[model samples]
Target: MSIKRPRTGGAWSWHQDYGYWYQNGCLYPDMASAFIAIDPNTKANGCMQVLRGSHKMGRIEHGRFGDQTGADPERVEPAARVMDLVYVELEPGDTLFFHSNTLHCSDQNTSESPRWSLLCCYNTKHNNPYKESHHPFYEPLEKLPDSAIKEMGSKLFEAKTDFWDPANDETVGTGKDQ
Candidate 1:
């Protein structure tokens, strides 16, 4: 929900676009993707499947969008949906990292066992990425001590709207990969 920050549907998108793209258009350009399986992932249990480097496929026409592909009677890439996707079978502690543009989706839990996982996304920090009207955008984390806040590189954006009377803002981007 926080990935797109406050844009399109903005804070009003808790359950809507956050999970399914219920709205016609709201998804921001994807930056990174990660998923953690609470229960080990498997085809029998409906684990996630991804199309390797699909995100890098030169911006395939988004059928869901009002693009030319949107109204095509046949899918732009019907085979790509299943054939191009790679099934992910993971160990309990295993982690998979991939480019943000990777096309990925999961299967149904046909197995009797339950599955749990955390899908994390990383994005390029844009300067004032939020929609113009959605000012004071915030995605909060648990309270951090001042020392830790400095360590994390957050900076104070505003004292007027941020939750804490005194706020901490990290100037993100000093980390390793990014």
Candidate 2:
């Protein structure tokens, strides 16, 4: 659940989600995420960009880049020279399921329209963290019927949700072992 405001949203540096998550205590790279578009996502509006099959490259070196941690350009630039760069354009309601290790990023939004999206991340039960952190541990999720979405409607936004606060948290890092 993130919003990329038009003309204000900044670009995301190339990186793998697992490149950071592995440091969170997850022993395996068995995770996935579903990104659902809430608004039209276009290249002009900073739609996601992926390096096809880059997940097979495994995790690359990551370090602080501006306010975010990004993949080492020394490694990523060489790969990008030969990998296929895909701009993931999507319409409202479109969904993209991607591996956690996938190398992906986005450009700054230059369009007049916003690009909002909801990302539902899932970790395999076998890949549960060894220690509790910002990410949820292995807890069985209650299955919801498809119609449940329509039933919730606007009420979903009204419900109280616990969100991760990086300011008060130290869950994000390369870990003590790294």
Candidate 3:
């Protein structure tokens, strides 16, 4: 999940999802993500940007960038010269799916409207990590009925799940919590 508050949101540096997953010991690049817009996404609100067809370029080197891991600028700058930079603007309920190696980032939200999106990531069983990592290995997904979702959205429903906090995570990448 990604969220950027109005006017005070921070920028996400250029990087590929594979760049981070590679560190987790995943053997293959068989992974992808679907970003579902929860609120209106526009350029003024710092919509996601991608280097079109960048997944073909393979994974780039990544290093710690403040509280996140980012692709090396030396490699990214040259790729940007050949690839098209596309700003992904979408309405609520819109979804954008991309390969793990796709280069992408988003700027700070300087507009009055908030920008929020939910990212559902997937990893193939063949791509499971050789060693244990922060993310889990191949686990069966539990399917819930449509009625379950309807009940969860109702005011009478009480939330039962706890959100994952990155602050408590002690990964080797960025020492500071975002």
lDDT of 2: 0.83
Local accuracy of candidate 3 as per-residue lDDT tens digits, 59-115: 888987676778988989999999999999999999999999999999888899988
Top candidate when judged by lDDT against the true structure? 3
lDDT for model 1 comes to 0.43
Please give each candidate's TM-score.
0.49, 0.82, 0.82
Number of clashes found in candidate 1: 11
TM-score attained by model 1: 0.49
Candidate 3 TM-score, C-alpha based:
0.82
Which pairs clash in the backbone of model 3?
none
Point out where model 1 deviates above 4 Å: 1-30, 60-84, 127-178
Ranking by lDDT: 3, 2, 1
Residue-level lDDT of model 1, residues 150-175, one tens digit each, is: 67575656565534221231111122
